[model samples]
Target: MTSVSIAERLGQEKFLAQTYNRDFLHVPGAFADPGGLVSFNVLSDLIARHRLEPPRLRLTVDGETLPQHRYAVPVITRRNTRWDRVHPDELHQRLAKGASLVIDQIDHLHEPVGDLAASLEGWLRAGVQVNAYASWTSTEGFGVHWDDHDVIVVQIEGAKRWRIFGPTRSLPLHRDVVEPEPPPAEPVAELVLTAGDVLYLPRGWWHAVTADQGVHSLHLTCGISPPHTGARLVGWLADELLASDIFRTDLPIHAGPEAQAAFLSALRKEVIGALDDSGLLERYAAARDAECVGRLRPSLPYVQGVPADPELMVRLTTGRARLDIVMAEGETVTRLTGAGQQVDAAPAAGPILHRLLNVGWHRLGDLADTAGVSVADTAALVAELVGAQIATVRSEGR
Candidate 1:
């Protein structure tokens, strides 16, 4: 396997800690060879192979989404399944007439994009989703709009102009009590992004984009899901306080004023005690990571058990998996948790498990050698991980 890491290629740490979610960051020529990650050919192959239907693949022009029937036709498959098939000729006609294309959740269909999303999730400690947008005209696909989550955009091909109007509201939620006011008459900043350039925009930053730069445009936008808010934290605290009888008791809604006051006081005390811990947020994050539902993949040929083949490749499916060393009884144990499952193994297997997490793909023999164990033992450990839905195995050619 190639040892080149994406972190070094993207200068991920420098940009993430310094600017992520704080302000807009524009990096010129950050991805000098963006084609290596994705290209027009890749997008075409995905559309053709996946039988992508309307909405999942759609078109927009002048801030209005075009109807699905304009570019695709519904068909019934031999397997009795119904799906919409894109009419290539009609699709091209629409694009030529100034319509932009959009594909949602492209990361799930593309390997390189999936890896990119996983890398971001590992770095940001949050869920990430990638969407693709392509345009042929200067016409705006979506008008001045704001996203509920922060986005990292990469210009894969051509150039596009952006007009950014600073946020009118602070940290707005998708379901909020109040809506933000209209943007001001003038934009705060204007930028034109070309091939290999990168831009990061925080949530609620109103921005409008158009490909009026005399060239077509293709780009990928990776959306980073927000972390837990104070409201969510309090909800989790309520669950944690279930051990107290006061929390379980009926509300004193019909009782006297003194009785209701006592109930409120007791509830406040339990909440305060839970919030007093210095590590409350840390604990909540760890718990969320442990229970995260990662991408699901099947180890087809090895449905029963992983064979003791040295050439087999193995990798973890979840980006948020947690690995830790803990004392169990008198012996040290290695615990791996993710994808809603947990597994414990001997301390000696730590090296093998850690490699699976950090490395994209490793041969069974290489992992066995690193762990100083037999190939059969390594296969057994990997089988346990596969059973837990946190890891997958494939033949060498795949």
Candidate 2:
């Protein structure tokens, strides 16, 4: 990866104001040396190291996922557990014949790729999962399709052509009420993404891709979690209404129309009153953000507590982790919420939390020095977080 952070290189402010959730964006030469971010070697190592299933790794040809049996053979472990082990020779034959190789959740498999994903999550304040795609032939890996979530693409090597037809339906969902109509005869925009290029496409945009540049292609698709919507708000509201007796009451099954109308009338009133609250969306977003669990990882070898070593590195497990101010005992308190835990710390710890909320690792000593805290306090705080799996720590050498 370049010394430059991915968020800055993405021009976060400009993209949000002009392009986010509205249109597509293409930036050529985004990274002068994208190979450092991820290469073919990394993918090879990951496959060899992990017992990846079809969901984690698979091959596709023209939108259909090829059977694992085609590229792997079932192996019975000593415990008698069976799983298809990918055969390098068969896998190569399939890819050479025009099938596209894909590794889902590549971010979880590789640390650098995980860092790349965390940068986007920190900027967007949304979950991001990156999948790697590699193709050797001019085949349409997924045919023509649209995604339920927005995606940012990084062309790591070679090139791939994309035919963008825009959206036929507005913000389609994975379990949508209606599917999009057939795309038009021609694409609205057609372009090739070479190494170091970046592209962003909003959800529901129709597109087709092919690696027909007479060279193999390797790319990463970073899909952002879908934005909170009115539908989701209503779902949340349903749970919130449980405190009220009317919502908790049984539905008037087999009741007369007049009685049913009375129940609905009360329900409608409750719904309207909740919707009238102007901060409903804001409140819902905060709740969801607090509940988000990002990249849960263990801080091994420190099972008991984080040691008071100044050189130990630390980072939040989730990029979406957030810090906010709340009054406690008539004094200002810093409340952190992420990885499914809420921690209220002294206001003095705000700086330390802020540093950890960023996208990379940090030394415990550096966090203490920068936050104006003692190494002992820093170790204590990190120990608490590490115990909760809200953050992880490692030695600098590791």
Off by over 4 Å in 1: 1-18
lDDT of 1 at 151: 87
Assess candidate 1 and give its lDDT: 0.84
TM-score of each: 0.94, 0.94
> Which regions of candidate 2 deviate over 4 angstroms?
1-10, 252-263
Q: lDDT (0-100) at residue 138 of candidate 2?
A: 91
Error of 1 at 337 (Å): 1.1
Q: Highest lDDT: which candidate? A: 2
Give the lowest summed-lDDT range of ten residues in model 1: 1-10
Supply candidate 1's per-residue lDDT for 308: 98
